[model samples]
Target chain A: MSAVLTPAVRRPLLRRLRPLGNGPLFTVAVLVLGVLVLVAALAPLIAPYDPEALDLRSSLVGSSADHLLGTDQSGRDVLSRLLYGARTGLLGPLLVVGLSTAGGLLLGTVAGWRGGWADAVLSRLMDLVFSVPGLLVAIMFVAVAGPGLTAPVIAMAVAYTPYVGRLVHGLARQEKARPYLESYRVQGWSGWTICVRHLLPNIAPTVLAQSAINFGYALMDLAALSFLGFGVQPPAADWGAMINDGESALQQGATMPALAPSVCIVLAVVAFGIVGEGIADRLARRER
Target chain B: MSGPTGLVVEGLRKGFGGRTVVDGVSFTLPPGGSLGIVGESGCGKTTTARMLVGLERADGGTVHLDGVDRSMRPRGRAGRLERARGIQLVFQDPYVSLDPRIPVGACIEEVRRLHFPLDRADRRHRVAELLDQVGLGEREAAELPRRLSGGQRQRVAIARALAAEPKVLILDEAVAALDVSIQAQILDLLAGIRRASGVAFLFVSHDLAVVRHLTEEVAVLRGGRVVETGPTVRVLTEPQHPYTRLLLDSVPRRGWDPGRIAAGRRAPA
Candidate 1:
């Protein structure tokens, strides 16, 4: 019965979800992402055949009755392997984004909010980490940790932590200098309270955008690792491993296996990029 | 009658990078009284006000809250927070003085929560009352700081400070950024609040008219030193120090000559 329009009531849910430049492109991008997520979630139930089952009878064939996309060199259904590949494909990036975001958020807030020696020490550490290329760092860590999916995932997280840290550090510093923080200080609110409740929320949009963009990077990095045999070992289905398996078959005229996974990786990366750019545009518009 | 239980600052000194910013500043504000600290930009008015409220630590001085020496108080977090409840500061820029993420209502309630352990219903009622007191409706309280106009934001800032129920309120260039009409409105509102609350005010400003209108007494600061101090009306109309007179003449009035700038500069230092 209340006629007053609160912020929650003012903007409808659908309108709010529409990021900047809400046109056909935004619609298609969101739809593509939704389909990817859904397919990833329903892979086990919807896949026609066991992804790992070796079948010499159906090996090295094109589209047929039993196999939709066709069988690979091992006679494993390429469609099934591709579908199951989403599990590791999505999980590794998620781990990279999660670990880096958490670690970076803490270190960045500390460096940004508490200036003087804390800032100096943390900033220099970040610089030292940043000097090394992320992939190289990941490879180094994987080499030490003994190569596996988890090893590369942890390595990628450590590699990207500095990047996320730098982004959040810059943003947190900007928010720290704002007058609201001064007001909080004068009000006797603890520095931790101000940093968490006030500063974090203001800088969250940037964090969200950063994570979205980093997701694409993480996907590519993990895929590259798997391709090099550092991540997602054999007998397990992954986009990168599938591409590797399909490479030799490409010359032999069985092109579908290698090409399908490669296309999916491209689509996923592009989708994440679009979403990140849209969020950034929306934030810019809001500021203006 | 209560033996002068008011704010008193003596020999306040602060320096930045080996250079003194606020030097030996001294002032006293009786309970329910108002004192204006007026000066040009970077004249250390802000630094002085900040030190008085413990926002900035003084290099050397004594700050007494209601005759209780607060300078040597324990420097722990809880102790500092308790001291914060005794004196609150309203910052100069209202646009960035509030968290844009939170609505105005929750902002006020946040201050309330720090001082009082009121339950949900009581906090909500108190927040609504504070909103009304600050001339903002409950509807506006539900909105974020960015959604509010500059004047409304300043009022919210004031309301937040008042929620602490401070014994002494320091307004550091508080009304300096508002539009003329809004400035007048805020000044009037402040006067009304003082009348109702009897809160001692350390009103820091550059505007002579605003200082004269709001404060009972004035302290003139020049080059980080208090050059003149007296009743506002007497000091404005019949100043003692040459610097104070120069400051008064600098105000844009009818037939104010531009040549007086040189003359004033030549006055005895």
Candidate 2:
């Protein structure tokens, strides 16, 4: 067999990038995400004025030399708020995605590998979680736990777990059904070794792509929670709360306060979406 | 009769949903002996092989490997590991039989690590030896299954199975996926490995020619039952059962007619 060694085919850069949306869009999306993270990290150094430092005399002012994104209803610098807002905006999704992905991976793999009564019970639990609306769950949690990031983050994590869990369950089951896993069993390897070592690596790419998309959804969900006044109360800079605060300023003819943060939210969400879909598309193409 | 270090299976039965797939199938192999189970698709040859390896639990029967009854699925981790040491199966499809992510070397080494208490260096050396035994080398071992051709990947699968150093190695249509020339090469490789390592072989295949070339004793299965059992030469040259004759005639060769085979298949034995 080694006498006729076939060299592995190396795909060209453009061809490889095709699945990630024609190269340019994926690059732009990645670039936008990178900038958002960097801006969030450097919020204090970058912001010219304190986000909550009020100047009531200049309240509802439009963009000017002093404030690049103008002043909100409270006369606080919208640019500073938006810069600082990225921190909590990204953090909420980060926590939600991290917790949910971990929970989903463990549950899904156990169910798929065991595939008896355990599978039935875990599957039904996942279905139960999936049945409830995530937003509704978050709202309920906030209503009970009192408005805060902890309530929404925990609520959304539980609600979104089924999304990751269901995906992992189906994929884990499919991967487990493959002959290689059986081959592993025949080699005397334990179920844990096979699942963690062989099964997980094979499905990791798809799971990662799913998590990316979930990150985008989580960001939007948390922002929605904040906009409804159930997250990030007054004095704290968060994109969603900034949007709500800017609403009154919008009526007074200062649109930058509302428009700037709204634009940021949309860009961030779209960038995350594109990157996630790009990863998924690339994986699908590779498998084909 | 079973030797001190051989396999003995009696009256193995299995069913899925309502239909029985394998019913009252039985066979035995002596130490280092080679046997082949020849049957048409849906005749339960593969299922029997799976049962022998404990992949699928037998609804009823006994699989005694070296005097230890292992028909029932092992109860715990230690039991499973012990049973796994007794038999290993090389699956039909090489393409999906090995993990796509792990390099072939790591795949082979994993079994050695699991079964043997060898240190890292010794394990590495054994993995290299197994790879060499299967006509592969360091370069091939480092490569993933996706990068290798079907023949090479099959060799890797064989090496991984051999790494366990089982008392019996079952090839479940192991060479069916390869090209004809590659199939011959792999068959030759298996013959060499059996001769060198003294590992008993239970070949499950539909190809009469492959079974004839490889196995000494042969069992013919039909509708999950063994209709005939004897030496390979006798079974091929002078088949007793009409079904075995039909199977032999169905094999494509010079002056073979598929229509006649199809008609023969339609006729009740």
Worst 10 residues of 2 chain A by lDDT: A2-11
The segments of candidate 1 whose C-alpha lies over 4 angstroms from its true place after superposition are A1-22, A64-66, B1-5, B16-19, B67-77, B118-121, B262-269
- Winning candidate number (TM-score): 2
* Candidate 1 CAPRI-style tier: medium
Q: Going through the candidates in order, what fraction of the true interface contacts does each contain?
A: 0.80, 0.90
Which run of 10 residues does model 1 chain A get worst, by summed lDDT?
Answer: A13-22
Candidate 1: the clashing residue pairs are none
What does DockQ give for each predicted structure?
0.68, 0.78
lDDT of 1 by residue, A1-288 (tens): 456656568577656566454576766777777888888899999999889999988788898887889999999999999889988888899999999999899999999888789999999998988888887877887789877788888888888888889988898888776778877877887789888887888888988888988998899999998888888887799999889999988989999989999999998898888887778878888888
**Interface root mean square deviation of every model, in Å?**
1.5, 1.1
Best by lDDT: 2
